[model samples]
Target chain A: MDGVHDIGGTDGLGPVGYRPEEPLFDNPWERTVFAMSFPAMASGLNLDAFRHGIEKMHPVDYLSSPYYEHWLFTMEKGLVETGLLTEEELRARTQQFLDDPSAPLPQRSDPAAAEAIVGFLRSGAPARREIDAKPAFAPGDRVLVRNLHPKGHTRLAGYLRGKRGVIDAVHGAFVFPDTHAHGLGEQPQHVYTVRFDSVEVWGPGADPRTVNHFDMWESYLVALDGDTDDRAALDR
Target chain B: MSTDHVLPVRPDYNADPTPDPVVVARVKALESLLLEKGVLASETVDRVADLYEKEVGPRNGARAVARAWTDPDFKQRLLADPVAACAELGIGGMQGEDMVVVENTDEVHNVIVCTLCSCYPWPVLGLPPNWYKYPAYRSRIVKDPRALLRGEFELDVPDEKTIKVWDSSAEVRYWVLPQQPPGTEGLSEEELVELITRDSMIGTGLPRTPDSPAGAR
Candidate 1:
């Protein structure tokens, strides 16, 4: 889905801010939200599904809220939507904390569970999966990024849509996020590093000395027959 | 180079000095609910935060970069199969399951970004910085990286050098293999490690020279 989160190539968002010694977390709440995300995942929320929840946020709120606030939104939404917790329960619990600053929250010491979650974080869940399918394109092949604008979740960035690029490298088949996010299936496919010259992507005026490369799944690309300017070639 | 362009100011660009109280309550509320419902133990949350704070981070990535600077074989391995190479130094996992380390040389420079989201190598460089996640960097870097690096980061690349911006739109995470600075041949791997700042690996900044103030032992 085209959302505010997909902010590549869009102009006038202002200068990038940098801090020489930025702390890991800006606020206490930020740390809590970050830490909770792992266990929330341990509680059966899919990573792609969690990302889509953030994508589903209202465009205005997505931009205004801080990063962790977005995570908090996803966690809350996932828990409720998955039937783990009710809306009233969450609202009442929030009110309790809001009303009493020193409210004693529930706690449990489960060292075994703690270690398991930390171990999982240490060794991440690898998205690469074995599929008995050959890669459609190989390195050095000229391909066109299919002009796809899916209303559902997708990894294809809007800026790269309908652009031309060359296959730089072929990564093994990985779980396709488009299907994984919707609980359809892994539907794994080969992911390639597609290289786009700056001029091709940003037009002739762009600095010819630069290039942008993106990791594109096989389905997002189409083989170009020859060096022709026919836009119709994309559909064929 | 493109300095004449007037960028729009986003009101929420900078984080507020004080966090919202309601937002604070909401997270605390969720934690309590998760615990009561047996979805998450408080210990698990604490352990996860501790791992990032104490165990994993830029130090791991710095060590890998420094090792490459000293060992040519390791550098080849890092360039060819970064995941396996980093694992030789015990620095592979999490968002770094499939890693690609691009080399920065005299003619070409490399930078990594996730235009769609903040996909960073957690076991290596740790979580991404605020600017890496914000809209300004995400939106402008891919379009005019030379301008963005020069204006915002204060690191100006010469016109002759080519900038390759890797937009990590998929699972394969990317990081920079910063060129070893001149006059650092005599330094030990440990000494070289001190010079590899997090931003250097991100391609926004260069590695520190041995005689520089920050690189001084």
Candidate 2:
């Protein structure tokens, strides 16, 4: 989905802010939202699904809200949409808190679940899988990013569509986000580090001293013919 | 305290130090619901938060950087296979499952960004800072990184050196292997660890030199 979340190469957002001593999380609520994301996923929601939830948010709300708010929205949307919790229950629970801020939350101690969550955090869930297929392009091979505009979730940034780049390295096959985000399937494919010259991406006015590299799934790229003129392909 | 005085209103909630009361209520509500529905255990959230706050962070990345600076063979291994090299140092997991370390040299410099979302190497760097997830950094960094680095971050790259920005759009996570600072030939690996800051590894700032002022970070 070409949402506000895909904000690469856009301009006039504002200047970046830096705080050298910034805390990991500002609000206690932020911590809760961050931690809950794990168990929310453990409840059968995959990472891509969670991301798509955020992507589905209204553009204005998505941009105006804080980062953790996005996480919280995703968690809530996933839980409710999956029937783990109902809207009325959530609304009543929220009202209870709003009415009595000091209300004690229900707690259940499950040391085993806690341990499992920590273990998973330490040993990540890798998406890489063995596939009996050869990569379409290799290092030094010129490739053009497919001009895709999927209505559903996709990892391909808006600016990268229709752009041309060179294959820098071939990362092993990994779960493709495009299909995975929609619960279609893992659809694991070869991922590559495609290097795009600054001029190629931003055009002639871009700074020549810089280049951009994107980790692109194989399906997102089309192999360019060796005999094809680079300039002609770029112009096209 | 008497509730009689006029309190100052923050113009921007994003910049305000105080937490939003509604957000706090909403999170507590979600927690209560999740707990009641048996979706999450009581201790799970707290434990995960503690793990990130106490155990995981940029210090882990710093240790790897320091070791790579001191050991040439390890540096080669780090560049060749980052995930295994990091695991060799007991640093691997989560968002860092597929890791790539790009080295910064005199001729080339590397930076990491995820314009799609705030995808970072969690096991090594923990949670990303607020600025990293904000629109200002995500939207503009890819287009005019030199300008952003110089104007907002105060790290000016010379015109001659090339800047390579890595957009981590897929499963692979990328980080920078910031060049070891000069005038630290005699320092031990442990001592060298102090020079590596989070921003340096993120490519917004350079590592602290031996003569840099105390508490510079």
Candidate 3:
């Protein structure tokens, strides 16, 4: 899905702002949204489900919405899907504040739960999964990214599709997100660091010496017979 | 060293104001319901917030950088397998499990960007900065990295040095091991850590010089 969130090489996004000293969260609400995301998943919402919910949003809404807003919207969607809350219930809650602006909402009964969430967040979870599979390509092999446009969730960025690169290193098997995102099994596959010349990606007049490397799953690549720089070789 | 190309005015990507009241209300409502249902406890939320706000951040990354500077074996381990090396220093987890530290050299300069999204080593560098996730950064830093480095960051890359931009497009996140600044040979590991800024690790800026005051950039 070519969503607005995939704004890698697109233009007109404006300048990169800088702050001398940045805060962890700019506001209290940002922290609130961040805190809810962990527990929402802890309560049964899968990480993929959460990501898909965000991807499901209208492009315009996604583009204009701030970062945390995306998280909040996804949290709401996940809760509704998990039978914890309904659209109307969420709407009513929003409307309640719209109507009075001073209403006291519910607070957590057990304050200790926040500690547990923090502990979990501090001791981060590793996404790498153990799997027994031979790597299709090894370091120094030439390969081309298959021109793929999967309608489902995928880590294959739009820019890297249909490009040629060299296998820099092989990072043993890890759960492939494309399959894992769809409730499809965690089909672990070898992940490789594919090194693509900046010219190979952006085309002529680009920096020839500059290389852009992407961590690609094995399923997204097809082996090239030999190292070739000709454009025609890549098309095949 | 000269190109006539004009750089666009960088936008204030951090312009998002104190979140809108309605957005606040919505999140507050969701929290209340989850709390009432016992699905999430407030204590956990508070703790997570505190962990990010105080316990974790760029300081962890500084320690890693400083250690690598002082110990050649650790630096080799960091460059070879960042996950295991970071673990030796107790800095591996979360988005950093598949970490790969790219070393910066005289002939080549390394910078990191996640064009698809903001995939950063949170456990090591803490949460990402606002600009790292901005659209302008995700777009310009790849196609015209030299421009972004010069125009926005004020760190000009010499024509002789090739800039290799690592777009973290997968589970693995990258952090730049900026070359240790010259003239700091006698500094202790703790002193070196103070010179390591978050921007240097991200490859947008160089590490702080010992003579310059902190946050001078």
Candidate 4:
């Protein structure tokens, strides 16, 4: 399930488009999608569900769609799958909007409910949670990112996979979104700041003094054996 | 949390700003359905959007940065435990959880990007700007920090100063405590907070000099 959303090291993405006067939301619909994400999650749709829904998008749709468009697509997918809204009902409503974009929505009956949802979104949800899981590695330990190409959700980028790096810091344990996204469980693990050399990631003729430090979960790494010693030496 | 092993050899990144009427209809439909079903209340969407758009923003991060600038003890605590420190100042939530504050010094310059996705410390700096999520900024920033900074933000780090790029690949978020501008020793914490622009904390730009035009943003 290698989704197209993971675009990291590949080049030719072009220049960063700078918007001098970028408004918070490009359009009114963007605001609705943005707002819906909060309550969708609050109503029991976890972060992973929302993210997984996006990953479920067809490559063409994902790439062609704009940022907020992606959100809207995934939000609808989650809502439909979770039984929050029937597909037929959603389609009918969509047709209504398509017929007239300015049509008013079926407003909330209770004002207090809106206030509570708003309050919840404003406070926000924190993913960090106390876990009994212990860290496998410590700072200064040299480890290699396991060459993994899982068919599901993962935080490990393709470029950094299989690369050796030193653990700069141990960031305690947190919810493992890879598993949590799939309704498995919060398989918490130790997350570390793994530092990789520019030369190692980009090849030689790169800045040796410079390095990339990334937060990597313990599951993505394996202790390097003597075989990796030569690469580690070159890294230094 | 996604991977791309079978993606096209060279997929083009096109950012279309124009809204798709079909998708807009779908979103509108979804909103109405959720509201009618009582799954979500009306104005809930507006409140969340407003919360990020107008309520929370870089000013929160500026306040934290300002407090750290003035109080060495607070700075130490901020670096040691960003969540606790930020929570102490009331800036801890969704994207802000497990914050890692990177300090900018004469020897080292720190910048952040989420190569896999745009993961930022939202409680502090609010939602990331569009540039942060764009393919160009995400890809180039990690590969060539010097060139990208100079070309995009007019930020030139001397060849001698080491550039460290932190990619927020995991949930842990990062924000830079940029080096305080020179000749601002007498400024109050509130003034310092005003000087801390969102870009400076992101390391794409720097704090404004006292004499350099007011309000760089």
Candidate 5:
């Protein structure tokens, strides 16, 4: 996502706006990823089914955690959820964690559980990202990235703030997100690259030696002057 | 590995998956499946993944950077018809997203960081080495721009002014047009182009010249 701020800069989502001053921690499982945990805990899940529902959640837990922190957290959570270990057992495990020489890897010497974790990890790949062989526009073509700003997980950027460029290549078309991330399922749209001139973008006093180019989605471009047919000379 | 390889040039994905086992495994599993399906070579996935930052990928934004370095009139043209202005040069799109270029200057030096999961302009600049997406770089950068850049990229700019750090989002991508190298009073187009290092071009540092070739401190 490139510089698509809310129309006229309102920070549309209200307070809790972009706070550059607040730097989140370097820990992979920083509190942010788990902010929804409270609601989840309140609205508990129906257990009593198949090796437990969280058997396959290791990948999500692990990738986003700080080193093996996920191992400690997920293990305890998993044990308690499946009734294999009670909350008191969780308490003892916590004390054991404190007493351990070093936190060891998950003892999934059990092949089925290890397999479950493996399957969970493999789920991050795209079933079909819905990308295409050809793009809406190709290299050297003139196009526009429609400037839009909506509150949600955005792929757009803010650096190319009101800037432009030419298409250097039409990287095989991928699904463009209609909402935020393509993960939660999205309406994939066509994307492209539109290059621009340095001097043209920043005023003459800017560098006089290099050109600036950037990427955009089909929705971003607004055919300036209706020069669609002339798109032939675009990438030239 | 050569020390040169450590200076944060583009990264080789073969050895640069995100530092998370699960994430790496998931990606690997998918790549393996893609290979089995004959959709890609077993190594082809590694090679294509390298395009994320290794070979100075998309950079459809380079024309804007080049134009910024070249024609003043074109600069104005960029402000108005950036996409069209880019078409005039011969740079195009990558990642299916339209391209846009931003300029960083003396008053305002722009450095882009994807505070959320390394969303970079891979089409033009190249794959973002693993470290760029590291938590150390991402979490601290926006708050203490000078510190993160200094620690990671070895850039030690003064605290006299607040550096404008632009965080590229998953929705849009960004590329920086670094200042041209110094001492090239009469360099040709190819010479100048060769001088544009992916790092400097991405706003991590300035492009190098014969005098300051390695971007030494």
Candidate 6:
């Protein structure tokens, strides 16, 4: 949903993927993350050049690092690039770790491991889903996906929300909380999908046959129109 | 860079994966700077660095996922605004911005790969595994999702579906609303919740029968 495309619809243009900027280097991934992440990380930090320095690098290495690996890596990168970590300090730390025979090291690690229930490994596992509760939206309901583009850590996409949509299908619910991504306590919430009309999202002139749906956590949406209007929207 | 055009140990573009000495140096320097600036305490930074990879990392996301699978409407709301739904579950809220969730259906499936740095939905799904950010996996997966998935993740999608690969551009993160698996419908919310594997939610794998979760990795 993000672009500089003239939304006045007077340009006679459709919803096109705005390149944002000229394609940098050859890799799209690198161009995307580098341009985005450091600025976000910079938000929490007190420095500007430090953030700029970190953003200058290609993001290929970033994709090569795991999620938090990048986090860890970036922190280190920022420190070094900004005159915080000295050449000698890194060398000393590396050398010491190599020599320390008694130092504890992590064992097997997995990135997608969190996706599967740990109980899946055990023969008899505790249930992870809570079935008795009723879901928030039904066959037809109007909802909005909040539009937010933050620098440091953000979860919202430009295209998905704000453009009006309806609730087409109701999937089961799961644990959603409000907290920092790292290990910590949480504030409980729920999730769902509110379908959007291409016409509404792209403007009244959009393809009537086309419909878009996005999954949302309850906290993201506030009802704009009731279910009946949504049902009618979906029927079209 | 994610391609197999194995670099001939060259000068520019294709560099080694070795941790950058300069970057590491910068990290240490930044730590010291933060301390000097009174922005952070050296001992606190050391403590943060110490337990970070372990303690204050991805565990919270795991708990959130487990809780979601156990609750229904929360799941629906989760399906609505992932970030807000997460807030309902007490997971994450406006540390800065909000979040949205997208469900993957039979006709249209959502696959997330960070073409840029490996930006992920860590707050909800936890930190990503190493292979996710691997050049080998990133390059091949988008061009050939079904094949690579079968090879790396051992996942196979039906031929009829169209895969919409999301190349994350901004800091905005994405997660898959994996289809809930069959056979556990009548089971208690708790039992049904047990079926919600994190991988399934990611669209990398599907939930299995209670009897079947025994063999998954």
In model 1 chain A, where is the ten-residue run with the lowest total lDDT? A227-236
TM-score of each: 0.96, 0.95, 0.93, 0.91, 0.44, 0.48
Q: Kindly indicate the candidate among 4 and 5 with the higher lDDT.
A: 4
Tell me the chain A TM-score of model 2.
0.95
Cα distance off (Å), candidate 5, residue B81: 4.8
Q: Which CAPRI level is candidate 1?
A: medium
Could you tell me how far off, in angstroms, the CA of residue B146 lies in candidate 4 after the best superposition?
1.3
Flag clash pairs in model 1.
A124-B94
Model 5 docking grade:
incorrect
What are the per-residue Cα lDDT tens digits for candidate 1 across B64-131? Answer: 99999999999999999998999899887789999899999999999899998899988889989888
Model 2 has fnat of 0.82
Model 3 chain B weakest 10-residue run by lDDT: B2-11
How does the DockQ of candidate 4 come out? 0.48
lDDT of 4 by residue, A1-236 (tens): 46766766657666677664577777787788877777777777888778778878897776555677777877777777777777788888888888888898776766677678766654656566777767889888888887777788788887787788899999888788889887889878888999998898888877665778888888888887566674554343
C-alpha root-mean-square deviation, each candidate: 2.4, 4.8, 3.2, 5.0, 15.4, 13.7
Better of 2 and 4 by DockQ: 2
Task: Tell me, by TM-score, which candidate is best.
Answer: 1
Per-model lDDT: 0.88, 0.87, 0.81, 0.79, 0.43, 0.45
Cα misplacement distance, residue A11 of candidate 6 (Å): 38
Question: Candidate 2: lDDT over CA atoms?
Answer: 0.87
Ranking by TM-score: 1, 2, 3, 4, 6, 5
The CAPRI quality class of candidate 3 comes to medium
lDDT of 5 by residue, A1-236 (tens): 22111111112111111211222223332222222121122223211111122223354342334422332344335434534445564454445544552444232123343233223222212212455444556566555444555443344444344444567544334445544232244455565545555555456754343334344566665543345443432333
- What is the C-alpha RMSD, rounded to one decimal, of candidate 1? 2.4
Report the lDDT of model 5 for residue B151. Answer: 59
Error (Å) of candidate 1 at residue A67 is 0.6
